[model samples]
Target chain A: MKRLIFCLAVLVLALAARPAPLFAQAGGPLRLEITEGVIEPMPIAVAPFLSGTANAGELAARISAVVVADLAGSGLFRAIPAEAQIAQVTSFDAPVRFADWKAINAQALVTGTVERTGADRVAVSFRLFDVFAGAPLGDGMRFEASEASWRRLAHKVADTVYQRLTGEPGYFDSRIAFVSETGPKNARRKRLALMDQDGANLRYLTGDMSIVLAPRFSPDGRQILYTSYESGLPRAYLLDLETLGQRPIDNQAGVATFAPRFSPDGLQVVYSLERGGNTDIHITSLVTGQTQRLTETPAIETAPDFSPDGRQIVFESDRSGTQQIYVMPAAGGPAQRISAGQGRYGTPVWSPRGDRIAFTKQQAGRFHIGVMRTDGTGERLLTASFLDEGPSWAPNGRLLIFTRVSQGEAGAPSLYTVDVTGRNLRAIATPDFASDPTWSPLLP
Target chain B: MPIRRSILTVAMLGLLAACGQNAPYGNTPPPGFGGGVPTDAVDVSVFGAGVTDTVLFPVDTWELTDAATATLTAQAAWFTRNPQATAVIEGHADERGTREYNIGLSARRANSVVEFLVLNGVAPSRLTTIPYGKDRPLEICSDEACYARNRRAVTVVAGSVDLGS
Candidate 1:
């Protein structure tokens, strides 16, 4: 009780210390309505959405919290606390009273209501309203789903608001599949992990039994392709997440495969094959398990990346006698060397825009983050560092997430992101070590 | 032209002899290259000036900058001066990229350097390349100042070269 009082006092003092109240007049739903078109972040309010007719078992609060959290976490909306909620909205179909919300300075409002459809099933509906504008931004959306899908409902609400306001797709509904790393640099322990975008509900897809690298999301969002060291041999495997099942993409030859990535259509898995001491890039059919050699001759052809339209692939090849990037048709043909003058370029990842390929280049002994158009032109190095590679795009294609390794007392890797403009560099928190990150498409 | 080439070759051989580990350094032997210099002593700290030259991209291209041709030209000259010193080009990426991609990129970087040297008259037999990516760093810190030092290709003489010793 004393602690509560002390915290309240501290908050009061701290808040008072500010030149003006950071949470003053415009911190409620009223501001949300008029502010929607203002281009600034619109303040909004989320009441614990009305619970379902079922038992709910604490999920009601959890679900409601998730919805608010998702919207707020995007650095977009300001979710006003329910503690100061002026009015209770019970029906998803009810007409909201804009005057009351606008008085609280909330320009927009998100109200959620759930109804039990079956024992484990429920119907969720959300209405986002612009208080000042006096109308819902989009048509009311309701979904018939399972209790576990409440999280998805949260994302949908955030997405709806995002689309309504920003005219861009929301990636809030996505998940990340990454190699969770532990141990030291020389002998590291790694596993495949899947987690919600906000780092919630983390689950290990692979046991820590063997080493794993580069877990990539399939187009369906229900599958992943990754390189595993099972059978004491490194190979690429396509895992059907729903079945908790696995299939080897290349088992007969049983060679070491590195840098496996999925085609944008999810029809193929392009990866590197190292057999009899020579490494090269290969493409395997997801359906037939049939494979085709993408590059031939001895030059360590590895790190294959595909353009978004699936017309061409940019990959690393030592064919010219050194490691540089070459662009080749997806149908398999002669490659034209694009990276002619760089020190060395590798890990060429084609952007979803189909215009640029992100790569790491080394020169004068330093590695840099660079990108170039599909024709191997307009190469611009974004960031310079000790080590930076693996540029995976943000769903909007505006940003990329890659790993940065800082060696000192701590010798390990961490995840980082940079605006494609090469500004606003920031780090994302990952438990333990993280690497080979492929961002999922915007969550439905 | 032939006399000049022969004289140049002989002078290079003499320079290797002066450096001590030259004969075994070049196409002479592989097993002899490793044992002498403590591989651990290979400094991961010194990457060249922050700018890397590539053949495809122009400058600062993590895409293997255009100057790569010229840098390799210079690196090839170094190899020419010390013929016996067979080199392993160690490629590294700065800390701004994904680790896996950087690793691959570094490998590509090192290979580009080796290729440039070979194309410019350095024997292909004299060069080996490996990409540490960002996994192994030359600089010890995470910031750009330190990162500039880490993104690099180190030409490690598989065998010790006599640095005029």
Candidate 2:
């Protein structure tokens, strides 16, 4: 008996001496596990879009509302309601009176002038001012857009102002490609709806063709990747904007696919596949259906995002006994836990800048928006409120925009934004409840 | 305010336990002072048994108030005494704004708490964060009071914060 026990103990010790497997060491050295959020929101103001007569098509009146919507939707600025706009500068050509704006306690101010250069051409020029410092921080390029391009022009203006204030590129001038809902949750009218970031200029790309979720924009803002319940099963689909083109990403079946995002170069799509009650992140080429599994985690893993270099992937998994962010090589290897905290974390989105990852965290029955360094250090929670999730980073990587839904009395879904510093809280303009927002990169 | 006071009282006791001094869990300060609210002890009658859609937030902004700050302060002190404790502070907002922006706003709220603890001498290495942009809820009520409560950061004990003392 003593001889047998000695042999068993020796065997156990040998097993324990082996190195940890490769799949367990993939996430880079930096990891940010956030444990707190800011108590106050920084204040900012977005001016109405400037307009003038001889307009391309109701030119002057429409742009202001669009600007308001863009700024508000970001949740980083407060659109000084036309009612409380301390002073209205008539045109971009006119000098701005910083005192008037500052008097209303506006920390930041925007002003613009619109000029009709020709029958089909209009130029819009805007300037952003720091109310606290009473100086012009930046000015936007003149947009000589046609009447039909008026809305886009306003977005560009807002984008410029946003970039100036937030010190990052603006996503306001971009578009939100989401599924427009017109029916009940069980049986919904699912169409690929493309609208301005402010919920204006709404158009349908996939005219009620299928049920879709997790719409992601192509890096250049030309196409989208979404999960469709078409063909009698859920699969990934890509839609082209210019021609309203549609193509099946892959013939995934038996197990459905969901939560898809494109690489920075648009060469690949990363998504989740439900196989026998377990989900894992998978990657496939845009040209060919050939796939490479990025996460071997047996537990559910969804919402995979690629690092800017496309060399690594950050995803959420329950391999650690709870849902948390994990990282592995883009080719799929050992996974490292980026989030090692208690509450469940999911919906991980890699920032465009590659310095951080944004994700949703649930703890003690509440959820929040948070970011952490690539290694999981410096974990900081940026926002907290009822039902805040689905973080989409602006092109600049300095600002984060996400959705907020109110339940019970003031229950409604709306968009909000904040800087990485946790300042500049504002709302985006919307006519109804909206969620699942994706920010587009700056247009050419 | 009185309810918040009650919450503060409980939070203080909880924070005290999480503090580096109070050894509720064990001797090696739990990771992050990552002390979390014991959901197992939540009363069904006061805050409701199951999760509801309702929440509460302060007026004009999403910042936690003085009372709220006091509660967090206690949490910070507890973090000082514990070494292994880790936590994820989650921020939230009411349903008044758009969803995308609220995610960032709520994240800022959570980050502030992390910053507070760090400023109070809590090690920055022990914290981790992730933001949930309006995907989860705590209450079913949508009134101002409910919204006030909803717009907050939940402390999540990650790793070995619960030492099973």
Best by lDDT: 1
Residue-by-residue lDDT tens digits, candidate 1, A153-259? 77777777766655566677788778888765433567898877767777888876566777788877888888775643456788888786998777765355767
Candidate 1 wrongly placed segments (more than 4 Å): A1-42, A52-58, A81-91, A103-107, A231-233, A252-254, A318-325, A334-345, A353-356, A360-386, A396-399, A417-427, A442-444, B1-165
Candidate 2 overall Cα lDDT vs. reference?
0.63
Model 1 Cα lDDT, one tens digit per residue, B47-90: 13442222222222334455555656665665676676676565
Write the residue-wise lDDT of candidate 2 on A1-444 in tens digits.
Answer: 999999999988876665432111133221111112322223455556555545533566577677776766565555667778768776666767878887787766766667788777777777777675666775456777886787888888877766665555677666666555543322234566677765678776765544455688898889888866554334677888797677877665455566788988998999876543345678889977798776665565778888999899888766666667889888888888889677878778888888988888777656788888899888888888767878888777867778776555445556787777666666766554555667777667
Q: Write down the lDDT that model 1 would get.
A: 0.66
lDDT of 1 at A342: 51
Query: Residue-wise lDDT of candidate 2 within B13-77, one digit each (tens)?
Result: 56555553222221122334444555333121221223221222463244556766676676666
